[model samples]
Target: MSAATLLRDVFGFDGYRPGQQEIVEAVTTGKNTLAIMPTGGGKSLCFQLPALVRDGVTVVISPLIALMRDQVRGLKEAGVVAGALTSGNTEEETDEVWRNLENGTLKLLYMAPERLASNGAQRMLRQAGVSMIAVDEAHCVSQWGHDFRPDYLRIGDLRRDLDVPLAAFTATADEETRIEIVEKLFDGHAPTIFLQGFDRPNIHLAFAAKDGPRAQIINFANARKEQAGIVYCGTRAKTESLAKALRDARHSACHYHGGMDADDRRNVERRFQQEDGLIVCATIAFGMGIDKPDIRWVAHADLPKSIESYYQEIGRAGRDGAPAETLTLFGPDDIRYRRQQIDEGLAPPERRAADHGRLNALLGLAEALHCRRQNLLSYFGEDPAPCGNCDLCDKPADVFDGTTPVRMALSAALRTEERFGAGHLIDILLGNMTEKVAQRSHDQLPTFGVGKEYSRVQWQAIFRQIMGHDLMRPNAERHGALRMTPKARPILRDEATIDLRRDTIKSAKSGPKIKQMVSEEDAPLLSALKAKRRAFAEQLGGPAYIVFNDKTLIEMAEKRPKSLDDMARIGGVGTKKLDSYGAAFLAVINGEAAAQHPQRQKLAGRNDGSIYDRLLETQATLSRGPSGTDKPMSCSASQLAKVASQKPRDEAAITRLLGDRAADRFGAAFLDILRDA
Candidate 1:
């Protein structure tokens, strides 16, 4: 039967998704192919339809037993003969699979990548007349990816041994990962690559800084109530606590993590698949194998480790193509935790540096000023117009050119010999007479009391943004001491500038007070401000309230400030706002130069900004008095920026960027610094 007829008769689909037709055609024609489609982009149909059209049984090498079983069960339900050979299979199930193979009735055979390890398994496929190989989650073969399956590497060997046309599919793989996939799977031979668009419009992206995170999660789940969702936590304990919290909120919830008993994990997986309206609070271990498509929402209780991991995790939601929502709550702790996780890993310096860069990309997304989808897709090298589906699209953030404040923070880190964490450094910035400040004599520094514009909380937020910018880093060896990176040096030298989210910088008080956003008297002005907010939000493509919530606007309207400084005195108006709507709102109240200063900046600091500086310094040391130096000796600032920005996970890309001379002298050393950074 033709692929189209099979789609209609077996899979019950009338047509292919946007990118699937070409991939199906390629695979159906028995050509080696690589398809990188977004999650929920109908990737299974691409291979399944092709399998029915192609002669003999098609062997699908999937990563997880659960995923394989789910796909096989799905295919069988469609009246297509399919079965999986996995450890999870009962003896009867295995017998049925073998019976189908013997009877020449099975159209598709699903097996985990681990199956490739057994010569007997390969022999079985070889004897079963396997004509084509379909590898799902193809990026697993690439070591650079977050989900590296060593077993996936064996599929390339199996492909060559079988000599079948291999077709690979994945949802997440950057250029480097793609290169590795090709080199490893196709043996450096280019396949018919179908680089599908990564945009998932149905998924509503939203991020909020962690202010009362537990309550925030409870409120989020409460709003979504009965819909199926997943809440990903950073720690196993957090998963249990959060899941209990969700249950206490009267929702059906359960927690899963790698630390759980294997049987318990399997049970949760089964429950999530079969039951509707079940919320699973889990660590990173709970996803990837999950094939549930109707998940209505996804919430991240902590920041994911890397951008790839984040994309893949969030991609799990809204897979059924219906509108789904995502709320990723992040804060200074999340950033530090993620950074420390990477730093503490056993991976080499280059891999760790690349990991840090990946984290930074996610940080940038969390602290995004405009459309989250636009910035997100850009990470995959596909640029498209702003998507109006994200929380940012609903209302934009108030931003400011935070160069001055950031410089002050950087200067404090520099002046303090990069020895202290953000706490002591913040004390110096806010002129706090803390005992630690006195012990360190930080109060005597030239940069002391420089950042008196923002409060301690506001300063902490700035430091967080600085980390998001990746201009600094926490030194693991130095006990998480805040340090300057190469990216920050330029800003400190007044040669560069950066914009920060003012709304994130200026947060609300923690203690409970008024629940209402605006007073009854300021309702109309609040509405006017909302209308203004909506306009600004549409301009930046964020949720209106996210930019300037009702409370901030009420404060703005009630105070009716006469100037920028006057409005600055309002509840949420302090801190830097480079891309701010503050000026426009100041135009609202016809505020003069603005409100008076509340007090000096104080509070916390961040550590992620210092990674890049170490990389640059490593290059610099190799450049000086170097007898083993290459002709160029050192990379130029722009070249180093390329190194810093497009973090080369491997030496090949770094070599290509730096050229032979510089790569030879500085390559290994540069990689070492990236590790420490």
Candidate 2:
């Protein structure tokens, strides 16, 4: 009956994660609470734990039926009594749930927000002994939220009618949604609020603007090989196409979308849930209810509708607090398509303007110079420090002064009557000899060749940066005509100089970087590990990396574990995996150990204690897991190799600085082994 007993017996986590205990304590004390946790941050436990500790059945109002079903199943899997009331249920199923509620056998009951609008459903809740109402996806009640659902507006009345304390939770909500949630869900009754920071530091965020997005996605996936991940596309057709392309490239991938038959969708979901390293190329429909937490990465082949949507979508990765990667490939077409959708929608002018503003925020994220993680959190009104985990923070961008070119482009738009789009303006700026330009006599305009200082591509980049700055707005009514805003008037008046990012043009002359080879000391061990993996994959009739990825193999060779337990402590070696392949990997490591002493003679002459100390420090840092992991020695192993060859202290350098993958596979406790060393 105690929280500790419930923690151990029901959920099975030995202790609460940070903020979980505080939230549970607050909710159990019968105070209204608003919990804003990042996705996979255990928002469910904040409510679920309190539900078990409460005296009466706790009613959970969720947005999606699929989400409700998944939550109930998960609760049952954890040996907690839970049920759901949805249209999919039979008469007998309804009776059984109600009977359990009446008999005090059900501790939690999940229902969609729409269910509260039904007369029959209202009657059941009116009679049922409900202690607390917990609203999931609580942001849906706020009209300002991206995923707002109209039915959620009815939930506020339930709080008054039921006269119970309420708790509402969402992974993402801007300041507007947070205020709206307080007003609509709790009737303006202030609740104890917890805004857990939004940064997922374990995720390495990268953005690539390029053509042939499908080819780019395939190449990225090829590097990852058999890692479990999701590829999100804007359309169902793109999802199917990309999935087919991935399959052709020899990856285990399947497509999912709302357009698919129910049976097929279910099958795809099952495969994605049960199998490791299976890629699911899907529309937004595939992720809302999915509870699979170890998704190694999430790639966006196209831009999402809003920053909120982007935040929620990418939040699906690194759920276990492990290192994961996110690569988003977007282009001008994506922006144009989204703009067209907004312009054509049937919303009020104010709402439409708000939507445009939200879209601009998303674009800001794509073009931001600072840390992507920091920018994302700032949009949600949470200012987090620059997370060194993202691509931008890891590698600083090259900024260029664009005041002259930006003014010239804006002048061209104004001189041409602001009737043309980016392509036409670009043509005029670059002194093109197109038929439209010749017919309109636009080549004679004073600003025609003013932007000739920059190349066509550089001019295009200037326009994009101008738009991103919100000094110029695209006239969606005229098929994206360039229109200057009041903000631009000052710039044209020479009040300010605009700075923009330099274009990163992919050169046709450049070749891809070759995959670097492991050091000679590690080569034999790496070969042995790969052979063992191939043999295991052959026995299992699956891809070689499915058993254990190259990342895992690299860690094994670097760490050189001495026992089955030590092998299990290597990254990516799960319990099921260690039992299956641990012995074979250990044997390879042992064989390599027996064969090695390559630098023994050289070590006798030199007293390089400082170098050894630094190596130990680098290993200690890498062993801490990704977010907390220290920067490895700034120099390369090959550089160290020139210094010493005894077991190659350079071998320590060759160790590939084990990433969060090791901590993930081996658990945080195993980091202690390296920490103590």
Error of 2 at 467 (Å): 2.5
Error of 2 at 558 (Å): 65
Taking all chains together, the TM-score of candidate 2 against the true structure is: 0.70
Q: Each model's C-alpha lDDT?
A: 0.79, 0.75
- Model 1: weakest 10-residue lDDT segment is 597-606
**Runs in model 1 with CA error above 4 Å?**
259-267, 413-445, 455-457, 473-490, 508-677
- Residues 1-677, model 1: lDDT tens digits: 77778888987888877978888899999999999999878888889888898889999988777677777778878898999888778899999999999999998999888878888998888899999999998988887788888999998898898899999999999999999999999999999999988999899999987778999999998899789999999899999999998888899999998787767888998899999899999988777778788999999998888888888889999887899999999876576556655654545446756776677788888988899999899999988898999988899889888888988999898888887677778889999888778887877899888888888778877877787778876653343366677888789888998888988777733334435454423433454455557777778888877677667876776677655445556776545541265567765445233432122111001122234456656766777536744444666766766665566767898899999877877888777766655
RMSD vs true structure, all candidates: 21.1, 29.5
Error (Å) of candidate 1 at residue 314 is 2.1
lDDT per residue (tens digit) for residues 1-677 in model 2: 99889999888889998778888999999999999998888998899999999988899998876677778878989988899998766698679887898888998999988888888877788788889999999999988778878899988989898899999999988888899999998888789998887777788988878567889999999999879999999999999999999999999999999888767877887788899999999999888888788999999999999888888889888899899999987676677557656654544445655776788777777777678888788888877888898889988877767778788888888898887777778888888878779999999998776666666656655666677677676553332356787778877889888776774421212223335344323543465566667767879999998889988888876666765545656778876676566656666566322221223212222333234334445545655445665433233343333332322222233343433343232223333332443
TM-score of each: 0.70, 0.70
Backbone clashes (count) for model 2: 2
